[model samples]
Target chain A: MSEVNNKKLRTKDLIYAGAFGALYIVLMLILVMSSGMVPILYILAPITVGVFCGTVYELCVLKVRKFGPALIMGLLFALVACNGAWYCFVTATACALLAELIIFLGKYKSKFMYLLSFVVFNINMSCPYMIMTFNRDGFMTRARDYYGEEYANGLSKLMTPWIWYALVGFAIIGGILGALIASKLIKKHFTKAGIV
Target chain B: MDFDICVDDSGAILKLDPRTKLVMFLTSSVASLTCYSMENLLIYGIVLCVITILCGKKWLGVKSLLIFLFLIFFRYEIVTSGKGSAAIGGLLTSLITIFLFFFPVFMSLMLITQTTRINQFLAAFDAMHMPNIVVIPIAVMFRFIPTVAQEWDGIRKAMAFRGISLEPWAIIRSPLKTIEYILIPLLFSSISIMEELAAAALARGLDSGNNRTSYETVKFRAVDYLVTFMFIGLAAFFIIGRKGL
Candidate 1:
């Protein structure tokens, strides 16, 4: 019975990976197509890059069969496409990797991966942001141009609090949506299909 | 299906070298990103539209469809808005501005993807100082994804034969037996492939490359320099201290 269940999980993970990878490619093209016409979609692209990376990583990396890879992949992809900071790329990738390794410790445990995804994305996305406060080559560096020294000096107070809240909100909501939707689908239909 | 947009028949574009295309794309994408205003975006958009159209199969006669979509979308957005004239003008220009951002680089992406074989694409990146870790892993991922996708279809069909429901939620709830049987086999297949891949890449001189060369070298053409300059000018206009975005 254990062997049978393991096979099913492996198959399901592969199928999900291919499905999401195609979805990522299409989403990329569609976003690029719409990027011309829609400004809001611009914001969505950087976030989705990490989500794609995460998806690939989960379906391909974590033997536990988690959705954390997809979330991180989506978020990373978005950041890269947006030409966001170099740190965003490194942090996003590192976060997903760290999350997967941590969740791997739980060893096929339930609901642990979901919490892992949320926590990792929050820490990963926010730390670089705080680090950038002193980063003269950073976005806050550019802030000085628009807001001057007083505004720049107070940037941590000005930006960090708000951005952290926003990052946490997005990661939790997006991570929940990704994991729940994937888990529910896999459990109901794909599991029986021998896709585990 | 190895789904992609229309593949260009002339593989000549591939011969041009991906590094060249990458540079072009970087210039154009950066230029577009730096500017948001109407006048600058128009200048960028016109040049992009022309370049994009030139990249594809002209005889397919997509020109009419392209123009029609461009006009209808732009015109209706501007005309329908109940804003004042300046605002209306701004809206229309905004539409054009958006178009510019999408048009050129997308053309260049399609151009390369259509012409270049996957092996060559990887080889080109390999030629660049791009790290093997990034290139090699991503290549393996793309190659595995399609094979696994096909395997998945087979598993799905097998399930459907047993009258199993395949809806998203339905699949999610299916029991543990299904996972162990179908997915593990595919996972094992993927692992098995890696051994062969390692052997093959090792055998094929993929690793012994202190003296690698290409059939075609990417060099800066006059037109490339011109295009690059134009992009630099536009980007500078947007980024420089005096002018507005």
Candidate 2:
């Protein structure tokens, strides 16, 4: 565990961030496809990011060995996935910035800090669901206008406040699972391959 | 599975500068997110679809348009229909709606990715006087995405050889094994690729403070301005519509 590298990011750092960022994006695309068919699956989507954050952050530490890759990757992801609502960029950037801070505080060496960084990074994964939930009023109105008042209200009640809490709760659990899995994978594969 | 990198360089969007296309993407994406009304989003969808068709992506254009229409109609049905099947129908409809809302942004990004060449994009960024730190990563990213796809194919084949199915159910069933088998290899290979890419970029003096020149000629045409204004006006119209002012 070294203190966060204060030197400027080199070309290698950018390359690491960009390449890993692409991997993250592609993995996210797969998760999105798997989850897209059912609304119930969408709530679980954020957890996927948490699941992979361990591997990604570990790779980041090993390769770039510097600060800001998380932030850069976050910005790149938002730019590529700009199809989401505008606030996505805001949230993505914020999450990355927070992850960067976490990594900094942990000096990029503490295993716990690495896990915590991922937990914060998981916040970006929650963006789409957040957008959907927050804009429920608009969606609800459209539903009511079409289905008649009774059905829309029933649909609304079905989506209780607990669903939102459940989303965050799942994300935190996913983060823990991801960190655990990543550590195992790092020990097994990354170490064998000399990647970490 | 192919990303939107230019092949024959024949699309209508390819004629516009990459920077201009980037602006169009940003505007349309923002407008789609900002405008809450379905009708406004529909208009944006139509505009994007028309552009896609004109760019010779006829099938993509048509498919997206159909999805858009289906979403609108289905959303109405989900609300008005009684509760017998409302849960399932409502679930799918809402899922599609979220995607539909971001349709224009995705379409525009597709146009850029499919039509613009990597060097052209880099040239455009260089012309904009972006720093090397930003430019190098983005350049690497453009190259990395396609390579990752290639690696993904290799991993899939190996998995198949070992009798591992990549279908969603298979993944959901044995998540840990899947990550160990599929994700580990993907990450492992990607790391090497990243190292090589970084070396290659540095070898090309990408980190130099000096100005880099390119063979690609990137210029803004009249159509670029026209498209830009059109999107700007569309955004203004949506904002005005939203405010009722």
Candidate 3:
């Protein structure tokens, strides 16, 4: 079983972590920057970001086949991007550490455990957006003052309090979709190519 | 703009020790985030542009300068023009505020990445006696980014050869296919590259347990101190002003 043969992280694993982490950041940055210009894409950003993250997570896990990659990846991304408040690093690290534990607990053999880790890892995708939660009142007030009472009210109505909570749901769906896609690609191309 | 760290030994700014560069980057990033005033942001933005241009990144410097000018222009227009429609005005103002707050920090980050080479940065970290756990991951990360870019370029060329429309519109039209064709190959290639990179790093004794020596000189000179003090002063001024001192 792959579980029995599991080894500790190596220098290569660290490199893989760094590479995949950079990939995740670059992907999200591209999407976020573009979404900023076309605000309509904002709605879809969280889920799609999650999807991209999940894909990277899956690949990282397969290649590294060890623990701590997620944590390092998340931490490096946070430090470089300063993607959010201090809490972002905390949450991202915690999520990745938890994923590492899950992969470890599953003895490195359970596909279910791996997929669960992907879901948790991808949740870090929501860290930047979480900034909105901290300044919700300020955001609303600014919207009201600048946009008009009607527009602000409409925005508030459209953005339910549970929007961030719903983002978690979107994260889960995205994670699943990304994992399924990665799974297919790995099976079809990578496994045969011996890359995996 | 190119975000990767530049290795060219051209600019006076580029000649500063990587440790100094790192300190400057950290200082600017923290200050950019902490200082909320638009005036401070503009000052920080201009200083950042000068540094970027001095570091031989003229194109990025100009691009960043233009962005800063646009932000200033946009704010001026909004403030001077009799209030426009509420939605448009609010949106514009909010965007301006966000841009003001973030652009400096972004520029600072870009400056560090664009000017300091990865090996030099990591060597400086080692010289500073940073924990191996932290240093190793960061070094790996720096190496990883460029490898991914190279692999991505290869994938793009392959797509072009295969008659896949590499345009934004085509990708937008069929994202899933793009992901399937482009990202999948990229991922597979990156997996192998990751392994090779790891092997190369291991061969260089990157994961060694002993104290390591670097040939790169990483000393803080007067300019480093001056830059550091300037940033500290800016932060202090912002905090004092915020406190109504």
TM-score of chain B of each: 0.52, 0.79, 0.77
- Candidate 3 per-residue lDDT, tens place, A101-146, comes to 9888987778788878887777766665554566566456645543
lDDT of 2 by residue, B1-245 (tens): 36543344664543777777777787886676567677778888888777777766777777878877888877766656755665676555556665775577677867666666767888888888888778766766666767777898889899899888988788889888877787878887887777777687778787787888888888778887887888888987876664557
Residue-by-residue lDDT tens digits, candidate 1, A70-180? 443434343324332455556656665666666656554545564455346434434334334434344544433322344345543545535545555555554544444
Residue-wise lDDT of candidate 3 within B1-245, one digit each (tens)? 44353456565444666655566666565665456556777787787788778777788898889988897888767766857786677667655665665576667666666667767777888777887667777766655565566677778788889899878899789877878787777777776676777677678888887876776777777877777677668767765664457
Better candidate by TM-score, 1 or 2: 2
Model 3, chain B only, scores a TM-score of: 0.77
Flag regions of model 2 displaced more than 4 Å.
A1-6, A80-88, A132-136, A142-155, A158-166, B4-6, B10-14, B31-39, B53-102, B239-245
Candidate 2, residues A22-84: lDDT per residue as tens digits? 788878876776565444465567777678656876677555657888888888878866444
Q: DockQ of candidate 3? A: 0.41
Best by TM-score: 3
Cα TM-score per model: 0.54, 0.82, 0.83
Task: Tell me the spans in candidate 1 whose CA falls farther than 4 Å from its real position.
Answer: A1-22, A28-57, A63-80, A84-94, A97-111, A118-164, A189-196, B1-6, B9-15, B27-29, B53-56, B59-101, B137-237, B241-245
lDDT of every model, 2 decimals = 0.46, 0.71, 0.69
DockQ of each: 0.10, 0.41, 0.41
